[model samples]
Target chain A: MEKLQEINNKAALNASGALSKLIDRPVKMNITMADVRKVEELSPVIGPEEIVAGVYLPVTGEITGAALLIFPKESSFNLSDLLVRREPGTTRKLTGLDKSALKELGNIVCGSYLTVFSNALQVKIIGHVPSFSFDMFGAIVSQIITEFVQKSEKALVVEIEIIFELKALKGYFLLLFELPQFNAILRSLDSV
Target chain B: MMENIEVNMGDLVVTKNQDKLTTSAVGSCLVITLYDLKFKIGALAHTMLTDRRVSHLKRDALDATSSSARTREGGNERRHEIRDMKYVDAAIDEMIKKMVTQGANKENLEAKLVGGANMFPALKSDIGKENVLAAKKKLKEEGIRLVGESVGGSQGRSVEFSVASGIVTVKIKF
Candidate 1:
C-alpha cells in the first residue's frame, strides 16, 4: 500500500488503454511500483533461463490477487509476429497458430488488467482462467511467487512495459494480496 | 561472503567457501542443489511446486482459479534460515537441516538437479514432471547423492553453483 502509487499508475494506464484497442498498435505502458522488496530484492528481471511468455491471472472478487504477464523470447516471438498475422520471423516456431496467438494475446492483456482493477479500484476484481506459461523466466516466476510470497512480505508490484510497433515488451504485473486485501484496496480507494 | 549469491523465487541459499549459488529461468521451476562436499556446504533451491502438500496459496479466486501459496510469515533469522524454499518437499527438508547444522556431513551429501523445464506443452500434468519426481524422491529418501541432472525439455536454464568448486554451470536457453 505504498500509497497505491497513484492507484498503480492509473491501473497501468488503463492497462495501456486496453492494449491500444486490441493491439492495433502504439501500445506503451509503464508502471513500476513495488513497495515491498525482499524476495531477494527481485533484481534479475527475467533471466533465470529467460524464455518467458507467462500469464497466470487470478484477480478474483473484490480485489484478490495474482496477475503476471511476462514475455521475452524475443518479446514473445515479436508479439507472436504481430499476434498471428505473421511475417517477420514467421512466428518463429511457436506452432499451432502461434500458440493460440500468444494465448489470445494473454487474454487481451490480462483482460485489460482486470478491467483496470475493476473500474479503477471500485472493486469486484476478476481475471480468472488465465494460465499460460512458455516458461523459464526462472520457471515462470518460480510458478508466479509460490503461494503469493507466503502470505506477503509485501508484494504489490505492477511493472508493465509494452511499447509497440518499434518493438518492446517487458512484464510483471503481480499483485498478491494480504494485509486485509491490501487494506481492502485502501478502503476501496476512499469510495473511488 | 557475497561472491554472487542470488536465489530468489521461493528462495534458498547457503554457502561456505567461495560462494556462487545462482538461479535463473529454470521453467516449470525447480533447482535444488545441496553440495556439502565435505563442508564446502552450498544449498540452493528455487522451487515453484512439487509439494507444499499439494496446492495451498489460497488467494480466493484467480477466476482463472484462486492461486497456490508460498508461505511467507517471517520473523527473520533469514526467515527462519531459508524457510520453505517454496516446496520441493519443503525445500529438501530445509536444506538438509541447514546442512547438518552448518558442519555438513550427513554422509557427505551431494545432489545437483536443475530447472525441471517442460515450459508449456499445453499444460496437463507436467509441472516439469512434477518437479522432477519431487527431486528424485527427496534425493532418494535423504540418502542423498543424486550427482547431477539438467532435467526435461522445452528449453530455458541458467544455473551456476560453485561453493568452492563443486561446479554446476548450465546455461541452456533454447
Candidate 2:
C-alpha cells in the first residue's frame, strides 16, 4: 500500500507537469488511491447516465489494462474551449480538431503515469493510441470494464482532481489488471 | 406509492408491487426486463456480457477439472469467475425464473430490451451487438415475446420499467 501511494504521487506530479506545459497554464493534479473494487462493482465516476467526454488509452506489456480520462459534460466543453483556444464557454460542440486535442491530452497525461510505473516496476508498459467518446458515464465505464473483466475481476480506482486557471474538475483513472499480471507487478515491486 | 429500485451490473430484481426498476448509463451492457400484466410482476437484469461459454477464463477453468489446478494456473482466478447473471443468456433465464417465483405466469410474460450501445465508435467491439443478439435468441428459445426494444447505436441510455403499467421508458442525452 505504501509503495503504491508513493508511485501514485510521483506519477501524478509527472502527469501534471506534462499537462501544465502543454496547456501553458499551471495545472495541479491530486490523486487519491481509491478502493480496490470488484470489477462488476466498479461504480461510475460521475452520474451513471450523465453524458461526459471520455478518452480511453489501452495499456499492454507487463500488464494488460486501460486508462480512462473522463470530463463531465460541462468540464469537457470548458476544457475544449481552452484546448482549442476559443473564447471561454464558446465550445458548444466538439469539432475534429477539438477531438484531436483531447486525445492528445489523454496521451500526455496517461503516458506520463505509465512512464513512472514502468520505471518503478521495471516492466515494459505501453499506452496505445487513445479513442475519444462523448457518451453516458455508465456506458463508457462499463464498456472499458467489460474489456478487462475477462482477464481480471479486480479494478483499482484512482480519483483524480485537476485544477487550472482557478477552476477545478473531477476525473477518474481506473486500472484493471489480470490476476496473474497483478501478482507479477506486486512481486516485481517487492523485489526492488 | 410507486417504489424505485436501482439495478446494478450483474444484478437482477423482481417485484410484483407498484414499483419501478431502473438501471442507468447502459453502454454496451444490455438491460432485460420481463413484465407479466396479469400478476403485475416485473423483473430487470443489468447484464454486461453475451455468453459465458466464450469467456477465456471460463474456457480455461473448464479445461482444468480440479479446483487446485484452476487456482495454481492463475492467482485467485477460481474465486473471480463472474456470476452467471452477468451474461445476457443466463440473465434472461434467471430473470424469468425470478418473475415466476414472484407469482408471474410464464404464459403472460413479455420482455423488453434496452441499451446495447457502442459508446466508443473507434474501437472495434461487437460486444453490444452480440449481447442484443444473444438476448433476442434466448427470449425466442424460451417462447417469450419481445414487446419493445431500444437498442444499438453509439449513445448511452437509461431505462425505467414500471410493473404496474408494464411501461419501459428509455432516455438518452442529446
Candidate 3:
C-alpha cells in the first residue's frame, strides 16, 4: 500500500506538471489521500448536494476501469476561466467552449497519470474520449459508481488539493479497476 | 420534534411515526417511497440498480457484504448478513413487505418515486431509465397508486419523504 501511494504521489506530480504546462501557469497539487476504498465510500468527499463539474474517461486495455476528475462549482468556473484565457472569476456558467476546455484538461491530466503508471508497471493503458458532466456532486459520482458496480465493488480513490495563483481548490481524481486487474497492478508494483 | 432518518444507498427504512426519511446525491439510483395514509405508516428505499437477477456482480457483492458485515464495537462483536438492497425490483418489494409488516394497509398504500437521473448524457447509459421503469413496473404489479414523482433528467436530486403527510420533496442544485 505504501508503494502504491508513493507511485500515486509521483503520478499526481506528473499530472500537475502537465496541467501547469497546458495553462501556462505555475500550478501546485498535493495528494491528500491515495488509497483503495469501497465504492460506497467514494461519494462523500464533497457534499452530495454541492454542484460540481466532472470529467470521466473510460480506461481500457490491461485494466478495465475508469478515471474521474472532479471540481467544485467555483473551482470549475475558476479553472475554466484560466483554461480559456478569460479573466479570473468571470465564468459564471459553462459554455460549449469552456466545457471543451475542461474536457481537454481532463484528458491531459488523466493521460499524464496513465503514462506514469504504464511506464512504471510496463502495462498498456488506454484512455478513451473524455465525457463531461456538471451536476450535483453525489449524482455525478453515483453514476460512475453504478457503472463500476456492474463489474467491481472497489476503487482506488486519490484526493487532491490543487492551488493556482494562491487560490486553493479541492479536487478529486479517482481510478477504478476490476479486482483482478487491481491485483495485477499491485503485483506489478511488487516486482518493481 | 419530528425525527429524521437517513437512508443510504441500497438500504431501506420503514416507520409508522412522523419521522422523515432523507437521502441525497441520487443519480441514476431510484428512491421509492410507500405510504398508507390511514395507517400512518411509510417506507423509503434507496435502490441502486435495475434488477439483481441481471446483474453480474450479485454473487460477488453478496459475498463481500456477508464477510464485511461483522463489526466489533466496544469489544463486542456482532455479525449480520446485509441484503443487497440496491436493486430496484428487490428494494421495492422489500419496502412494501416492510410497510405491511409495520401495520401499513396494503390496499391503502400509495407510492412516490424520486431520483433516476442520467448525470452523464454522453455516456449513453440507460441504467437510470431502466431503474425508473423497473420501479414503476413493480409498483404496478403491487397495485400501489403512483401519486408523484420527479425523475428522468440530467440533474441530481436530494429527496425527503415525510411519512406523516405522505409528502415527497425533491431538491436539485440549479
Candidate 4:
C-alpha cells in the first residue's frame, strides 16, 4: 500500500511539472472536482449544466488513436471564425472553408494534452490528421468508447474545458490514453 | 448537325453523328458506354455503385418506369429506348440498342469502360471494385464485347468517347 501510494504521488507531481513546462507556465494538475468545474465554466457555451461528451484516441498507443473533439454547433462555428479570422455572420458552415481551421485546432488541443502526458510519462507520441463531425454528443462518445476504449483494460481520460473569449465559445477536451501506455507511465513513476 | 453531349453524374446522354461525350474526375464510379459506328449513336452511363441495393429504395419510383418499360420492347428498338433511361443496367442495354438502331450489328458493337477509383481511404467498402465487377457482369450478360477498359485503382480518370470512331480516351491521375 505504501509503495503504490508513493508511486501515485510521484506520478501526480511528474504530470504537474510536465504540464507546467509544456504550457510555459505552472499548471494546476489533477482531475479534481474543482478542475472539473473550471473546465465547465471556462467557456460560457459548455457550462456545468451541459452533458459530458467523449473524445477518443482509438489507436492511442499505435500512432495515436482517432481523436474526436466535439463542440456544440454554435461553439464550433464561433471557434472556426476566431481561428480563421472571419467576420461575424460569415454564413459559413463548419463543413465548408472552416474544415481546415477545425483540423488545425484539433491538432493544437490534442497536441497540448499529449505534450503533458509525454513529459510526465517520458513517452514519445505522434498524432495524425484530425477529423471532426457535429452530432449528438452522446452518440459520438458512445461510438468512440465502444470502438476504441472498451477493448482496453483501462484508460486515462483527462477532461478539460477550453474557453476563448473572442468567440464566446466553450468546449471540452477529452484525452483518452490507452491502458498499456498508462500502465507504463505508472511503472515509470514507481521507479522515479 | 452533330453536337457533343456531356454526361454528368447520375445521368445518361446519347448522341449520333460522331459527336464526343465526356465525363470528368470519375472516382469510385463506373463509366460504361456502347457505341454503334454505323448508326453514329452512342450512350454512356456513369454509375457510383455496383448494385442498386442502397439506391433501390430511393430510386424505386424511377426504376418502375425504367426496367419494365425496356422489357416490353423487342430487340433494337427496345434496347435503344431503354438506353435512353438512366441507371447502370438500363443505360448499358439502351446503348447497345441505340448502336444497333444506328445500323451497327449487335455482334459487331464494341463496349468501353473507364473509372472506378477508391477515393476515400478510410472507407473499407470497396465501391470502386464493386462497380468494375458489376460493369463486367452487365456487359457479358448483354453479349456486348468489351474491347477496352480502364478500371480499378486509387487514381481518378476522365473519359472522352468519339461516337464516330468508337474510340474512348481515358486520362488517369494518381
Candidate 5:
C-alpha cells in the first residue's frame, strides 16, 4: 500500500507537469491520500448537486480504471476561454469548439497521467479519448462509481486540486483505479 | 423532526411523513421515486445500469446483477440473496415492498423518475436512453403510473421528493 501511494504521488506530479505544458503556465496541484468520505464531507468538494463540467477518460490495461477532470461550471468557461485565447469571461456558453478543446486537453493530460503508471508497471496501456459533459457533479461521479470501475466497498481515488495562483482559478482531478487490481498495481509499482 | 434522508448511488431508502428523500447528481444514472400519498411515505432509488444481461460491461458492481453473473453455471445451490437496490428491477421491487411494509397501499402509490443524462457523448450507445427505457418498461411491468420525469439530456439533476405533498422537485445543473 505504501508503494502504491508513492506511485500515486508520482503520477500526480507527472500530471502536473503535463498540465503545465498544456496550459503553458505554472499550476500548483496538490495530491491527497485517497478515501471515500461520508456524504457530509463529500458534498462540498463536489457541491450539493452543483452543476459541473467533467472530462472522463478510460484507462485500460492490466491495471485498469479511469480518471476525470471536474470543474465548477464557471471555472469551465474560464478554462475554455484561457485555452482558446479568448478574453476571460468571454465564453458564456460552451460552444462546439470549446467542447472539442476540452476533450483534447483532457485526453492529453490523462494520456500523460496514465503514462507514468504504464512506465512504472512496465505495461502497455492506452487512454481513450475523453468524453466531456456538463452535468451535476454527484450524478457524474456516481456514474463512474457504479459503471466504470470494479466494485469495492469504496473508491481507490486520488484528489488533485489545481490552482492557478495568478488567475485565481480552482479545478479538480480525480483518478479511480480498478479496485480488484490493487495488488496487481502494487506489484507492478514494486517491479521497479 | 423532518429529516432529509439521503439515498446513495445505486441504493434506496424509505422515509415517512415530513421526511423527504433526496439524491444528487443523477447523470446517465436514474433516480426513481415512489410515493404513498395516504401514508406520506417516499422511496427513491439511484440506479446506474439498465440490466445485467449485457456482456461488455466491466463494472464490479453489487446487487443481484453481479451475483447472478457470478453464479451463472454453478450447481443448484441458489437461494434468495439479500436484496440490493443497485439495479433498476430489484430496486423498484424492493422499494414497493418497503412501502407496503410501512403502510403504503400498492393501489395508491404514484411514481416519478429523474436523472438519466447522456454524459458520454463519444460513446456510441446511449446508456442514459437505455436506462430510461428500462425504467419505463419496468414501471409498466409493475403497473406504476408514471407521473413525471426529467431525463435524456447532457446534464445532471438533484431531486427532492416529499411524500407529505407527493411533490418531487428537480433541479437541473448544467
Candidate 6:
C-alpha cells in the first residue's frame, strides 16, 4: 500500500509539472484596454459593443499545442475592410474572399500571441492554417468552448472584451495541450 | 480517338464521341454526367451548391456576386450568347435539352454521378452532403434515374466521363 501511494504521488506530481510547462504560470494573460486600442488602430470602426479576447494555454506540458483566437463578425468585418481596402457599401457582404482575409488576420493575431507562450514555456510552437466563419458572437464562443473545453479533463478559458469607439469585438482564445507530450516535458524536468 | 475536355466548376460539357470530360478537385460539389449510347451524347456538370429554386447560370453569377451587381446584370448578355453553361440544375437541364435536340429520347436518358467529397473536415457545415442530397432529390423530381454514384468522404475526387461508352471513372486523390 505504501509503495502504491508513492507511485500515485509521483504520477500526480508529474502531471502537475506537465501542466505548468504547457501553459504560462498565471493561466490568464494581462491584456489591458490599451492593447485593445492598439489592435483597433490597425483597423477602423472596430465595434459598437465591447470586444472580447481570450487565450487558451495547454496544460499538458507539451512542446506543441493548439491556440485559437475568435473575433465577432463586426470586428472581423471591420478589420477585413481595412486590410483589403474595399470602400464601404461596395463590399457589404462577407464573401469567400472576405472570409479568407479574416482567416489571414486571425493567423496573424494568433501567431503574435503564440510568441508569448514560446517565451514563457521556452518551447517552439507552430500553428496550423487558420479558418474563419461568421455567426452570432455568443454562438461562436459557446461552440468553441463546448468543442474544445468540455471534452478535456481540465481546461482554462481566457476571455477579454475590447472596446474601441462605439464598436466592440469580442474574442475567445482556447489552448489545447497534448497529454502524452506534457508528460514527457514533466519527466524531462524531473531528470534535470 | 479520345478527346480530353476540362470541365470547369459551374460549367457543363456534353459529347457523343469517345471524348473524356474530366474535372479536378471536387468538394461538396456534385458531378452529374448523362450518356445516351443510342445517340452517343454525353453531358457532365460540376456544381458547388444545391438549390432547386435557381438555375445554374443564376447561381454561378451569385457565386461571383461579390462583383458589382451592374456587372452581373450586363454580363447576362454575354452569358446567354455562350453555348457552354455551368450550374448543376441548369447544366442538367441544358444537357437534357441538347440530348433531345440531338435525337436522344428523354425517357432513354441515364445518369452516372460522382465526386462529392468533404474536403475540409473542420468545417462543421457539410456542403458535400447537401450537394449529394440536393442532386438526388432534384434528379428524382425531374424523372431522371441515378444508375450509380460515388459520394461523400474526406478526400477530393477526380471524375472522368467517357462519351463513347458512358463510363465514369473516378480517381481518388493520388
Which candidate number has the best DockQ? 5
Q: Worst 10-residue stretch by lDDT in candidate 1 chain B? A: B59-68
| lDDT, model 1, position B65 | 26
On residues B1-174, what C-alpha lDDT tens digit does candidate 5 reach at each position? 888888777778887868888887777778999887887888989887765533443533343245544433367755454355666787899899988998899888888888777767665546778788888999899889998988887777888988679889998753
Best by TM-score: 3
> Per-residue lDDT tens digits of candidate 1, residues A16-80?
77667766766777765445444334546654555667767666676566766667777788777
List the pairs of residues colliding in candidate 3. none
Task: Please say which candidate is ahead in DockQ: 5 or 6.
Answer: 5
Instruction: Score chain A of each prediction against the true chain A by TM-score and list the results.
Output: 0.32, 0.86, 0.88, 0.57, 0.75, 0.49
True contacts kept of each: 0.58, 0.83, 0.87, 0.00, 0.85, 0.00
Give per-residue CA lDDT, model 1, range B90-125, as digits (tens). 788888888888888878888988866665544443
- The most accurate candidate by lDDT is 3
Regions of candidate 2 where Cα sits further than 4 Å from its true position: A24-45, A150-153, A186-191, B58-83
| Candidate 1 CAPRI category | acceptable
After TM-score superposition, what is the CA distance of residue A167 in candidate 3 from its true location, in Å? 3.8
Which pairs clash in model 4?
A58-A65, A59-A65, A60-A65, B28-B117, B39-B102, B83-B94
3 against 4, candidate with superior DockQ:
3
Q: How do the residues A153-177 of candidate 6 rate in per-residue lDDT, one tens digit apiece?
A: 2222333333333443455444444
* Residue A108, candidate 6: C-alpha displacement in angstroms: 8.0
User: How do these models rank on TM-score, best leading?
Assistant: 3, 2, 5, 6, 4, 1
Q: Of models 2 and 4, which has the larger TM-score? A: 2
lDDT for each residue of candidate 3 in B39-137, tens digit (9 for 90 to 100): 889899988787543454644644454445567778997655444577787777777788878777899988899988898888888888888899899
CAPRI-wise, candidate 6 is: incorrect
lDDT of 3 at A115: 79
Chain B TM-scores, listed for every candidate in order, come to 0.33, 0.84, 0.85, 0.75, 0.84, 0.79
Distance (Å) between predicted and true CA of B13, model 5?
Answer: 2.4
Give the per-residue lDDT digits (tens) of candidate 5, residues A45-130: 67757777789887776656667777788888887887787887799998888888877766765666577657766777777768
Tens-place lDDT per residue, model 4, A1-192, is: 233344334444554554444444344333221121222133354431223222333334433434455566666666565556677557346655575566555555555556555555555666554554343343243334323322212333334333333323444555444444545655765575
